[model samples]
Every structure is written in C-alpha cells, then in structure tokens.
Target chain A: MDTTSYNNPEQGNQEERLWNYIDGTATATEKTLIEKLIESNAEWKEKYRELLEVNQLLQASELEAPSMRFSKNVMEEISRVHIAPATKSYINKKIIWGLGFFFITMFIGFLIYGIGQMTFTGGEESTLTKNISKVDFSKFFNNTWVNAFMMINVVVGLFLLDMFLSNKRKEFRKQA
Target chain B: MSTGLNDNEIISKVLSGDHQAYAIIVNRYQNYVFTLTLRMIKSREDAEEVAQDVFIKAYKYLADFRGASKFTTWLYTIVNNTCITFLRKKRLDIQSLDNEHVFATADNIDSGMRANIVEQKSKLAMVNDAIGLLGSDDAQIITLFYKAEQSLEEIAEILGLETNTAKVRLHRARTRLKEKMETHYTEEVKNIYN
Candidate 1:
C-alpha cells in the first residue's frame, strides 16, 4: 500500500490480485493463493487491510442529495417539452415489410420475364443492333401491365428526384 | 414521494398518457443522477441543470426504453452522455493536459460544503473528496460501481466499454482513489481511524 512504489511492476501485479480477490472475481485457485499470501506474508496482509478499508469506505459512501425542489423543477421543464410517443405507435413494421416485399417481387418478376423473352440466335453474325431492332416495340408497349409499370416507375423516379433536390436545398440553406 | 410503485409500472402509466407519473421516477433517481452528474461536471449549478435535462430527455425518449435492461442502467447511460456533452460544450479539455484543472473545479464547489458537514472529517467526506480529485472517467467508473452498485456488465453498457474493460477501469479507479486518500487526506484518515 506504499504510494511511492505504485509504479513498481510488482506492486501493480499485487494490487491487481488484491482487487480481483476483493471483487470476488478471482478463480478458486487465485482465491486460495491470495488467502495463503495474506495469511503468511506481512506485506500482503497490510495491503489487504488497506484495500479492505477502501472497499468499506466506498460501500458506506452515501448518494449525494440535490436541492429540495429538484423534482419539481424537472417536472416543470417536462411540461414545456414534447414527449416522444412509443415506437410502435408511429412506425408500422408490417407496412414497411409489405413495401419491401412488393419491390423485391417486382424485381424478380421483371428478371424472369426478361430472361423468358431472350431469343438466343447462335449465329456468328449476331450483333446488338440487329437483336434490338427485331424486338417489336409496339407489341411490348401494347401490354397494359407494362404501360402501368412504366407509369409507376416514372412517378417514383420523379418523387425520388424531388426529394433529393429538396434535401440539397436544405443543406444549402444550412450552409448559407 | 416514495410511490410504492415499481419503475416499469410508472413507465407504463406515463406512456399511457399520465405524465405526472414521471415525477415518481424523477424522485426515485434524482439523488443518484445528481451525484453522478456532479462528479463529472464539478459545478453544482451546471450539474443541476444537466441533471434536469437528463430527466427531460429520458422522459421524451421513455417510449424507446424496452425493458431489456434495468431502468437505472438506461437512465445512467443518459446521465453519462449528457454530462459528457455538457463538458464538451463548455470546451473543458477532458482529453489531456488541462484535465486535472477541469476536474479540480470540484474542490471549489465541495470544499465549503465538506467543511460544514462535520467538524471532524468523516470517512465519507474524505472518500467524496478523493473521488472529486479523480478525472471524469475514473470518477464516473467509481461512482457507477460503488455508489450505483452497478455490475461490471451494466457499467460496460453505460460507458460503452467491454465488460473486461470496465472491470480494469474500476480496479484502476479504486487504486487511484486509495492513492488519493493516502496522499491528500492522510491526517484526516488517521484521525478518523484513531
């Protein structure tokens, strides 16, 4: 328990052992070893007594009391502020999952439909332009589902763009 | 103010639109919260302000507390973070060099109070003064472990450290506190134990 030797390597190890023993976190072997050392070694016994006193002092320390009106002040402040509602009240997990399911299903469906329409003409002269030209644009657009999907895609794209631009404008205002 | 109701029950009532129920929660924990904030902040006035804010913030976010941990652990976490924020906003150099000076401000606040508490320096006053001499992190770990009686796991959760780290920190803080008592209050300690 010598403050002068606090930096000594041996002192540090001994303190750590004493702390582990005091906190009751030492293994059985460690506990036995510490007990033997404390019983036999005068230095270890002195350190043990000091640390035990420190532990007793800490345990007996009382919680500091605030002013008498503390709770009233806090309640008054609470009255002026907004309390957040429970998470379940505002955020619907089911709706989020439903939207996610809709998007994923649409993506997979589009992938399958795209693969089904691919005509693999295995010819040496096959070119990208020739394949694209063979696709009947009018027939593809003539499908009601495809037209409706395209309209939804445009609306979503525009909504995302508007959101992005508004965010940028807000950032600019903050900077300005 | 001792409402015989448990923390969870009070929380449930508060969430169900009974805001006055929060006063019970505040009353139950104000001393603990104030002690911890005062340990970190050093200034009783500012600590009181920060403690009030901690309660307000906790009430605002009450719905987010999910009963996964004890309410005291969650509340202490808020107290810890708010004090850190208050320290940062005050531009106190908590990281290095000026750390001692920042922590030493507690002496000005506590010295008079300690004097008036007892004519013969009591062990409790000596221990409190020794704690005031430690840096914020060390003081916080000691207070959480000793005063709050939080386990190593709960201390880790509150301080955002690993449990092992919290254990090490607690040991080191106790060591430093013992050293402080030895070096600073040697006469008082001897007089008290004599």
Candidate 2:
C-alpha cells in the first residue's frame, strides 16, 4: 500500500499535514479535518499509524551511553586545568558598599560646606534676598589642586565613556 | 547522576571552588552530550573526543552562562558547535546532510552494536539503525526532539534557527526518519503495527 515515493509532492504534503496534526501544531479545523480523513480515508489512517509508530519508536530509543569511566576521565581532565573561581567569590561587597558610603558622605559634606559659605544679608523692611549669583566661585576654582582634580575627573569620565561606547559597539558587531 | 543537587546548585558549587562538584554535572550530562555528539559526528571515537572537549569547554566558560536560558540549552549549543567544528576540520561536507560518507559512518557504528542488542530490544535497535541511516542534521533534530525532550523553541535556540524553521525542519526530519524506517526496516515496522 506504501507504493508512492515519499518525495512525491502530494505524498510530502500528506506527510507534512499529518505531522502537523501529530505534533499538535495544526489548527482546530485542520485537526477535525484530519480526524475525519483518518476515520474515512484508509490512506490517511495508514499514514497516521505509520507516523505515530515512528514517534513512539523515537521516544522509546535509549540514549547511547559512553564508557563506564567517562565521567571519571572528564573529571581527571578537568583536574589538570585551572578553573577560575566564581564571580561572587572574588568581588568584595564590603569594599563596594564602603566606597559607596564614602562617596555619599563626601557629597553631602561638600553640599553642607558650600551652603555654610553663603551669607544671606537682609534689611528688615523691604528686602529681597541678596543675589546668590554674585557669590565668588573664583576662590574655589583657582586652587591648582582643585583644577587638577576637575581635569582628572573630566579625563576619567571621558575614558569611561569611551570604554562604554566601545563595549556597545562590540555588542552591536556581535549581534550583526 | 543525581547528586541531590540541581544544575544551578551544582553550577554554583563549581563556581564557588568546589571543583569536585563538576563531576556531578559531568555525570549528569555526559550521556546526553555524547549522544548528540555521536549523532552529529558519526564516529564513536571522534564523538567521545568531541564530547569531552564539549564538557571541558562548558566548564571553562561555565561562568559566562547567565541562566537566561536553560543550562541544557547552553550546553547543547556547545555540543552542536563543537561537532560542527570537528566536521569542518575534517573537511566533511556539512551542507550535504544526506551524503553517503555521513551515512556510512553511522552504518559502521550501528552494524556493530545492533547485533548484541537485537535479542533484547530489536525494535529499538531497528530505530537506532534507521536513525543512523539519516543525515547528521536530521538525526540531531530527531534526537533533540525525542531523546532530549526539548521543545521546538529550545530546538530553535540550540540550532540557531527561527522557531518556524525549526518546526518545519523537525517535521521534515521525522518524515525522513519514517521513510528510512519504511525503506530499510520494513519487517520491523510491520511487526510494530502488528
């Protein structure tokens, strides 16, 4: 009864449709149609049995095992090579939190020091607050050490930006 | 294989410097990895070598596995690629999945193993031989679907195929396996129906 070549276009279509049904990928209407065909058409019925048997046979086949010493050999091979420690092992959370706390404390201390330097002069009767923009920033900006720090910060920021952009470019290249 | 630890737990232990814990992973997945390698490479010796390379490669890069996908997905991806590389180095025709050279290698393995097991599991033996007759691509897809029990989506991820393409390939692979069974093992297939 299985005389037709599987490569025959019609036969391939039949097999594909039956496979979709077997794999549960077919729509409800297609499923009903296939069921009716299997019930009424001997060809569909035979094809269904063959395909189902193949599915069952595949599921039943045992996975091929390696030699009894396979794992031992792998473990032995691994022993000779150095494996790096896990990520959590090397990174110190305490140091990270300590740096974070120090930065926060320094930021707040600078804000408080700057605010303390501001003087609010007021007359009792008709006073608007003094123009804060007139407060001299030249004293802070003129320190060689401060200027050096700002330059260092700018250079470091640029370096970090370059690193980040390069990494993003590498990721884009990989995806493409 | 069950060291009372799941894959993630084992991975954590291995990462945390319990190098011995990797043995649990090796024991757990060796057969699976070996089977996949064998299906693709078609030689037990080369498959064994490649399977070992796969495990070692996975271990070296285990830290890179981010758990974005199942661990098996990552591991099988390594297996699939390693086999492809092995085939390429040998300069085998990978694109021609139905090549006689590929099928002949499978036949050599199946013919030797099929005899001793025939009395106990003839049906399984027949199916295994029929699968050996299939090209590496078809065999890998079938093994992934049935033996590994991977969903089509996982198969897609492992094979680097679109989900729809994976579905179609799986359908076509099974169809070809059916054709092989019908053509090569008609007697056993008849027995299955009876």
Candidate 3:
C-alpha cells in the first residue's frame, strides 16, 4: 500500500512491473529490481506470497476433461463436416492494402490510356498532348446543371464508400 | 503432440483432402476444448454437444485461419466464441454476467434457494460453481492462465488484450477469485485441505 518506492519514474508502474515479473513477462532489469524489492520490502514480499497462494489455489484444481470418446466424437463430427480447401480469404490489412494498390494502378493505367487516345483534329489530325493548350474551364464549370449533378454524385459516392467500408469492417470482425 | 505432426501440418493435410487428418487435430485439442465448454455451459451433455459443434465449426472455418498465432489460440478462440454463441441460442438464465451479484450478496439470497443450489454439489463442484459465478473476463483469464497453462502473452492473445493489461486483469481476477473462495468456501476450503 506504500506509494513511495512503488514508482520507478523512468520504467512505469511498479505494481504492473511486479505482476509482469510474476507472469514471466518482465524484462531482466525489471526482474532484478522486483527481486531486490521483494527481498528488501516486507510489504512487497507479503504481496508476492499472498498472490502466490492464490496462484497455487487456482492451479490446484482444473475442470475434468470429457468422456473418453471426446476425441472420437470430435472426429465423427469432423468427418461429417466437409473440409474445404484452405482459403486465402482471411481479410487482413495486407490484403486490403494490396487491393487498394491494384485499384490505384488500374486507375493510372486507364488514365494513361485515355490520354493516349485523345485527339484534337481541325483539318490535320493532332495527337493528344499531356499539356492542355486550351482554356476549357467555362465548358467544364459553366453549366449549373452539370456542376450540380457532379457535386451531388460526389457526395453520394462518398456516402456509399463510407457504408461499404463500414460493412466490410463488420464482416471482417464477424468472420475473424 | 501426435507423432510430431503440428497443427499447421494437420491442417494442411486436411486442406489437401486427407479428411482423416482432421482427426489428429481433434484428438490433440479435445480434452482442453471439452473442459472449456463444460465450464461455460455447466452440463456434460450440453458440453459434449457444444464441443462437437465447435470442432465441426473449426473445421469449416479452418480455411479462414491465416496462422497469425498459435493453433491453440485460434482453436480456443473458436471454442470460446462458439460456446458463447451457443449460450446465447439457449437463452439460459445466466445471460448476463451481473447476475452473479446475487451470489456475491449471499446474505440477501434466500436460504432455501442457496440450500437447493448446494444440495448436490460436492466441494469440488462448489469450487467450480464459484468459478462459474465469476464474471466472464475473470473466469476466462483464470482458466486460460491456470487451467490451460497459457502464458500471460497467450492469455492476452486469447483475450485480445495488451500484455500489461492482461497482467493487471489476471491479478484482479485472482483477487476476485480469492474473494469468491473466501465467501463461498470459507468452511469447505478449510475442511477439504485439512
């Protein structure tokens, strides 16, 4: 219950450190520090002994395994189930990133293709140039109806995307 | 442990159409899985049925396992989730963890009801009943740590918690168990060991 030496300003919580040591998750330095504390601090030692008693009681009794046919029964059930081939379908971060990369790459490819095929012809045919040498801003943005449709579709598309991502997350959790 | 065949290999074999290979997986995990379901459902017959369904479910979902952790961890997750789902389907009276508060407030509980509860249970059975009375988190950590002999890291993986958090939870769980034992088995614990 004493809070004085219980804290290590740099290391973190002393109670958590003591627990980590007991659970075998502590670092070497922490183990040494906890050991020293246990040896020198009566309260720490008592705490350790008290927890160890609880651990002993917990480990003392375990629930019994099922009947002898447990494995056979399990096997029977397994036999009944059709073993499908291992699926590469476990949705994970890497797969989602890969899919994103594929879509981005495809979009870039399609953009390049569209640009390559664009032609400006008056009398003589002229291939499309990456740099636009015309002012078409009025045509693109001057139409109120077109602009309104574009804006609405963008908003609706974003809403759809959000819904899609949310549903995918839920599916991932339920399957995972 | 079966002929040096790891779970991954057995899984691979099963996936490769060696359907019988799943038997190895089943045998390897049967006891531990059975004990877990039994503790959750508190009935051998129901536990057996749930345990079988769990295995069948595991086989069906084996393809979904990407081996992110140990096989036991994945299998136990399925076992735990399946048991929880089964409990939901049955709609047992123990639907909420808070109901155990009734046991905690022993003096408020009817003597007849408590007596009816303890009538057939032996000391060990009483111990198990006390554990069942623990909230799911505490009961699960105690089982995974002590009964399953899982390390703190494994328990964390099982519960999807950070290691430090799992350690704290395990400590708190032990404290709760101690309180439960002291409350319910104050006489029995002393008598059984003496």
Candidate 4:
C-alpha cells in the first residue's frame, strides 16, 4: 500500500530488488543486497512475509488432473497408426486373391454350361458343328427351361461359393 | 533426478520406433500436462482427449525437438499450443475478472456455513464460472503459474515470451484475481450486514 518506497529513486530500486529476491528471480548480488535490506528494515520483513503468504496460497490451490484414460488413449492411437501399415499389405493381397477367384469361378461355370447344352440335344455331333457355325447358338440351345435351370444353378452355386470364400477370408483374417 | 539416460536418450529410442520408451516421458510429465489441460479445457472428456493428443503429437515430432530447451519445457510448449488450438476451434468464451464480480454479487446471500452443501457447491461453481470468464491468455497464465507451479521462466519458455514480459503478465493476472476475490468478499459482507 505504501507507494513511496516503490517510487523513490533509491528505495524504489531496493524495493524492486527485494521483490525479485522474494520471488526467487534475483541474481546473487541482488539477493545478498535484499537480504541485508531485510536485516536492516522491519517494513521489508513484513512485506516479505505478506508476499510469501500470497505465494503459498497460490501454490496451495490444487490442480485437477485430466482423465485417467489419457495415457492409454494416446498409446492406443499411436499404435493404431503404427499397425495400419503392416495390415495394409495383407488387405491388398486379399483383394487380388478375391478377384482371381471370382474370374476363375465364372470361367469354369461357363465351360460347364456350354458342355451341358451341347449334350442335352440329340444330334450331338451335328449340333456341335452347327453351334460352331452359328454365333447365335441360342437358336439351337433354345430349350428355355433347361437354359433357365442351368443359369439358376450357376447363380446358386456361385452364391454358395462366395459365402464359403468369405467365411474362409474371415478365418484367415483372424489368424493373421 | 539424474537418471543415467537423459531425455535425449529416451527420445532417440522413441524415434527409432521403441515406443515403450515414450511411456517414460509420459509418466514423468503426464500429471503436469493433464492438470494444465484440465484447468484450461474445464471438461474431463475434452481435457483427456487433448492431453492424449498432446503426447502423441510430441512423440510424432520427437525428431524435431532440437534440444534447444529442457524436455519438460518442450512438452509444455506442445501442451499449451494444443490447448489453445482446441479452445479456438471450440470457440469458447475467455472469461475475465469481470465475471467474478457478477458471481460475487449474485451469490451474496449464500455465504455462511448454513448455506448447505448445495449452496457450497454453487459457490465453487461460481468460482469456476469466474475463472471461465477470464480471457484465454489470462486464464492460461493463472493456471500455469498458480496451479501448475511453474516458475515464471518456465512459463516464459512455454509461452515464448521474455522473462520480464512473463513477470508483468503474472503480476497483472494476480492483481486481477485478488480484485475478483475482494469483490466477492465485499458483496458477501454487504449481504450479511443488510
């Protein structure tokens, strides 16, 4: 509350020096000077005590801790990124295998359906020759019921195979 | 405090992909980081999320740490920056000493011990509300110096200010807090007398 000591040229400098000392920010010589001042002046001592009390109170206020999950969540996030690269290559390989299996199954089903159609007709050799000559082989293989049945079987079989493959993929993924 | 392996050793290990070494750094400063974040963010959920992000970012950029300062200082810098970013993105109002005056007057009738537990809780809520009224920089400096127990020099380093500047800011913040407290006490006294 006394501004004179902090404003007068000589006492003002000492007051500032004393403040730094009390705050633990003074250099060695300044600290020694302030110590001497405290020894000589009763007022400085009282000011020192008051400053310390304020500092202590400020320090006493507890700091709340952040959530307990902080460390775990951080580590988990970092590891998630780290593990991604390793699994990315595996995912790429799976995509290639899936595409290969899809095309191979389609080729096999086409061959099987073509052979079934050729065999169903009575003039087997002649039908085959005609089938080779006509691009529109549906005229010779115009049995709609048989064609429809074979198409249905092909779709059902592919569906079952897809389910089986997907199951296997899941198992493989789990193992990996 | 002198472990054979220094922060540099631990950081080098982390950069070489030895992630477990990171736990050492986290364990060392997690409390300080968490406390600072919690005080600033005010929500446990957001504080935890931000604190976690701070550490993870520190780890990712461990290589960028040139040993220009103490490891803890560097960590504080990151935490401070992260909290500021979060505050900005969320567009939270920076409360100043102005709000404390309002709180003090509004809750004047509920001062005595007879005010009950709920009233006590409201008092604390008002105090926190006052804190929330401080400007972002003021609130941060108050928390860093008072709550975190960081020296002015350490705070200066974290906030990238000169020591004198930090001291001035600290003085201003303390003055503001004291004023707010005085206003609250005066209001309560008036209500009691009335």
Compare the candidates by lDDT and give the number of the best one: 1
Q: Give the TM-score of candidate 4.
A: 0.56
Q: By TM-score, who's the top model here? A: 1
Ranking 1 against 2 by lDDT, winner:
1
TM-scores of the models, in the given order?
A: 0.72, 0.69, 0.62, 0.56
A116: Cα error in model 4, Å: 89
| Worst 10-residue lDDT window, candidate 4 chain A | A81-90
lDDT (Cα, tens digit) per residue for candidate 1, span A18-83: 989999999999999999999999989988887888888898988888899999999998999777
Candidate ranking under lDDT, highest first, comes to 1, 2, 3, 4
Q: Which 10 successive residues of model 3 chain A have the least lDDT summed?
A: A1-10
Q: Write the per-residue lDDT of candidate 4 for residues A1-176, one digit (tens) a residue.
A: 33244235665455455557767888998788778868888877765664554455556655555566666777777775442222343468878779868766766676566656553333456565665654445643576755675576679679979889977865664476
Q: By the DockQ metric, which is better: model 1 or model 3?
A: 1
Q: How well is each residue in A58-155 modelled by candidate 2, as lDDT tens digits?
A: 88998989988888888888888876555776789999789757755765565566556555443444434454455566665665655565575678
The C-alpha local distance difference test score for the whole of candidate 3 amounts to 0.69
Instruction: State the weakest 10-residue window (summed lDDT) of model 2 chain A.
Output: A120-129
Task: State iRMS for model 1.
Answer: 2.0
DockQ of predicted candidate 4: 0.11
What lDDT score goes with residue A47 in model 4?
57
Better of 2 and 3 by TM-score: 2
CAPRI tier for the interface of model 1:
acceptable
Candidate 4, residue A108: the lDDT equals: 69
Ranking by DockQ: 1, 2, 3, 4
